[model samples]
Target: MKTDSQLQQDVMAELKWEPSVHAAQIGVEVKDGVVTLAGEVSSYTEKLNAERAAQRVQGVKALAVDMTIKLSQLGKRTDADIAGSARNILSWTSSLPTDAVKVLVEGGWLTLSGDVEWQFQRQDAADSVRYLLGVIGVSNQIAIKPSLSATVVKSDIEAALKRRAMADAKTIAVEVKGADVTLTGTVHSWAERDLATRSAWGSAGVRNVVDKMNLV
Candidate 1:
């Protein structure tokens, strides 16, 4: 096995090779298989990319990202320019509501806050912000409001959970009511428990998942 220091070196090399980032401005440190990334980037995408580069390395047991984003470059742009850029981004993606979402830029940092009917739309908003030049970081505080009725949401969650349980063929029981999914019963291992939780997340209209499943 490669030592922690050697893994760190490899991660650094990987970051340096990525075309999207300026590797010199990023710092890498590893201890006991955990990799720590520090420094600053000009955009949110670069910061995300830097962390992803570290995660992809073969020997990384975990990642700790502490990178800062510089928004100063965005300060020079006019409001019209910023709004135009945001509009262009919205036009390129059909998943998000172009008008419902609001963008606020301060010292280059962009904060997006709004309510979207789907989690994918929330993701789309964040993605749009990251693509803009001079954006330091994006705070995605978008709420997920269901386009479907409460009854539909509950039905969807129940159906999804049932399908997942059947597919896994485990002893995990799932109970869904409205936006809440409760997992009960027992599984052979902790991995099964985690799998159940993830399966719940994949279900649409699920506001919150309560895992009550016990590991045997």
Candidate 2:
């Protein structure tokens, strides 16, 4: 196991390697394999990229982000402009229905609300505005429209996991309650955990995914 100091260094290195983040402005602190990032970035997108980079480090078990977005002069715009841009961008995104999302901007933070048939469409709405200039943050409040029966959701998710050759397919338990899914299992790495969660979310009508997976 890596020491806390070693893990901190690894996370810092990972952050620096990511081209989108300005690593020097960020502070890395690790305790018991959990990393906390504190700093300021030019935009919300860079803050997200920094967090993702730190999570990619091997020794990071959990992450806490205390970063803030300090927009540059060129990145500053009125909330009205941000809202208009968000709408335009979402409308242009092929994966999302043009009118499926409603945009609300408050102090450069964008809040998206609406209903979509799939999780990916909701996510696409957020991604469409994440990189826009003057965007300090994004809140995706888009809801997923339920479509399939609970039994069908469970069977479809299990079949998909088996097809993907997930190592713990047999061990992982899928419990469907209404539109929610709870995954219980032990995986060897974060990648496997992500795979299991993705499989659950891919099921039709899945509104919430509760991950109770343990890393071995």
Candidate 3:
């Protein structure tokens, strides 16, 4: 087991190692196995990158982001510009369909709404605009179009878990209610838990994934 200080050092090293994050501006605090990141980043993408970098460290039981986006003068733009950029980017993204997502920008935050046939498309819409100059945050309300049965979703998740060798199918209880999936199980590590959640989300027509996985 890693001590709190050791975990903190590891997370800091990871932050420095990540190219997109400015490690010097970030302050890392760890208690038990939980990590808290506090600082200012140049962009919302950097903030997201910092969070992901910290979570990559082993022994991270939970993560709390206290970081804020402090965009540069050149990085800041009007809400209208942000909306226009978001729309243009989403349109160019080959993975997303045309006019599939509607963008609304208030202040610098971008909100997306509409429907897509797959979870990946919904996520792609957000990712397409994550690097926008003035985007402070994104709320993806683009829902998935449900087409598969609950039983099929459950089976698909189980199959994916088995293929990945993350855990036993029987150990992770997958419950599908409508387009929502609730995962209940014990995962050996944070990475495994993340994989399990992704497996649930990867299923066709899954709208929401509720991760109730306990780490052991």
Provide the overall lDDT of each model, using Cα atoms, as 2-decimal numbers. Answer: 0.71, 0.90, 0.90
Which of the numbered candidates is closest to the native, going by highest TM-score?
Answer: 2
Instruction: Show model 2 residue runs off by greater than 4 Å.
Output: none
How far residue 88's Cα lies from its native spot in candidate 3, in Å, is 1.1
Error of 1 at 119 (Å): 1.2
Per-model TM-score on C-alpha atoms: 0.66, 0.96, 0.95
Q: Return whichever of 1 and 3 wins on TM-score.
A: 3
Worst lDDT window (10 residues) for model 2? 119-128
Off by over 4 Å in 1: 70-80, 146-201, 208-216
lDDT of 3: 0.90
Q: List, residue by residue over 1-216, the lDDT tens digit for candidate 2.
A: 899999998999999899999999999999998899998888888998998899788867888999988988998999999999998898899998769899999999899999998887877788889999998888999999899999999999999899999898888999998999999988877888888999888987899899998776
Q: How well does candidate 3 match the true structure in TM-score terms?
A: 0.95
Residue-wise lDDT of candidate 1 within 1-216, one digit each (tens)? 779889988999999989998999999999987889999887778888898788667777667988887656444566456657876786678887667687777765677777776666777788876767666567777776644455665555456657766544346666766666687876554445556676665566665668776544
Tell how far residue 139 is off in model 1, in angstroms. 0.9
Off by over 4 Å in 3: 168-170
